[model samples]
Target: MSYSVHVLHNGYSYLKDGVMRANCTCTLIKGPNLVIVDTMTAWDKDVLLEGLAKENTSCADVKYAVGTHGHSDHLGNLNLFTAATHIVGYSVSYKDEFFIHPFETGEPYKIDDSLQVIPTPGHTTEDVSVVVKTAHQGTVVVAGDLFEREEDISDPSLWRYIAGSENPDKQQKYRNEVILLADHIVPGHGPMFKVTEDMKDVARRDQLTQK
Candidate 1:
């Protein structure tokens, strides 16, 4: 089955008082399974519920709730998705029941033929990114903090200085990999952006070799 990716909410991030005040981008994928990626902050719960209602989906219908990382901004509203199989970073759970998955070792969790969750890390070392293949969008990568925004593709410093990635080198490497694999990307704290050859070139950490 083919899937459709929807940007339920585009998040924002800004630096203030040596702190990053941020909200994570929340996405929805509908196909074989109803998936919600990054629930956003708790304060935005009502807004998230409303967004789901508008799509004719309820929290109860969601089969999977994926938090790109353990950050509060990303998983704050997870309590709303109790029935969903929860994927928070490298851990998977449902209520008190837990299931093991080797995300840390690069094993991707497949939700369906059209959707999969791949380990991305870098932001906090256990981060994940959702990849959706749709008829219209081709392939869309729901990249969490691995990319702060579209500008991060062109300016490395924009993300390096603000995202505080735990492993800058790995983040950069995977960011390049995602850019190469995706037709579009939904970044952590910004609007979606189209992938282009120029963007791929800019994202690559090593320019000596060509792909």
Candidate 2:
């Protein structure tokens, strides 16, 4: 079956007089087994439900609820999908039962020919991203904080410094990896963007910044 990526909720992060506020992007993978990536914050419950309804999907329609990482803003609504498999960070589980999965530190977990989940750390060691093969877009990577926002390509500080990167050095490496592979990236806290040379340059520039 074919798969496509859809953003249910666009994420954002901004500073308000020294205080930072943010929410993670929520994305849906439409295919044989529907997958929802990054549930956003818990407070956005009503909005999330409405977003799913708008897509003609219900909570039960989603087979997988994936949290790119264990951040509160990303996995807050996990409880709503008890029937679906929850892939948070490197671990997979169904309610109270945890399951072992090889997505841990190597190789992308293949869901089907059209979709897979890659192990993309650096935002946090356990971070992961959903990669979907779409006909129009080619390859769409629902990267978590790995890309941040499209603006982060020009101003790395927005994601590395202000947003708090656990490992800027490691983050830069994965940033380059994803940029090279994806035609479009759905970032953790911003709108999706088409890959451009500038984005590639920024990813490469990070190596120089460290020197």
Candidate 3:
């Protein structure tokens, strides 16, 4: 069976022969098993399963179906992977309780003992980011909504919304968690950032300055 991956760019998807653009960033990582990061809007179970089957991996082997948060965009197609175990941080596990879904803790479930999950809420109550250490990719962070590359990354309104939301104190905690990451930053909706030592220094400096 052929193993491959597909990184569906959130924006600029319409440039391909004038097709419609979808929601959140969708990533299908297929190896011995299958793992989907986020399921964008307008995408359903059949479409995702069909696309994944192209790589010779069926939805049945989807050992892990996870979301960075409870947002509609991220968890839109979660029902498609019902057979697979769901992974989400403890803070937002209640959201899936109604569905009678059994979800494991993101931090404890490691992929090859190299990838880790850092719970960084504030964008929402259950937002989390995935950190990976691959032989080829080195250290990388899959920051879902918690961080972005667009100008909105530091927009005052967004920050205010996060800081003044239902969990205001958690905002600082989330920022602190991000500051601890000295690895490459990959956002859910923008270009990835090479996390160099210099960039980490800048990010830490900015965090301290904000404090």
Candidate closest to the true structure, highest lDDT: 1
- CA deviation > 4 Å runs, candidate 1: 16-19, 203-211
Instruction: For residues 1-211, write the lDDT of model 2, one tens digit per residue.
Output: 6777889999999999998899988998888989999999889899889989988988998999999998999988988887799889898888889978786557787888888888988889889988888878889999998878989877989879877788887788888889978899999999889998777776677656766
The per-model lDDT (C-alpha) reads 0.89, 0.87, 0.57
Supply the TM-score for candidate 3. 0.67
- lDDT tens digits, residue span 135-159, model 3: 5555666666665443334463444
Clashes of each: 0, 0, 0
Per-residue lDDT of 143 in model 3: 66
Q: Put down candidate 1 lDDT per residue, 1-211, tens digits, no spaces.
A: 6788889999999889988789988999888898999999989989899899888999999999999998899988999987899999999998999899999789999887788999998888899999999999989999999999998776778678877888888887788889989999999999888999887776564633434
Model 2 spans with C-alpha error above 4 angstroms: 201-211
Tell me how candidate 2 scores on lDDT.
Answer: 0.87
Where in model 3 is the C-alpha error above 4 Å? 1-6, 11-22, 31-33, 42-56, 89-112, 153-176, 179-182, 196-198
Considering lDDT, which of the candidate structures 2 and 3 is the better prediction for this target?
2
Which candidate ranks first by TM-score, i.e. highest?
A: 1
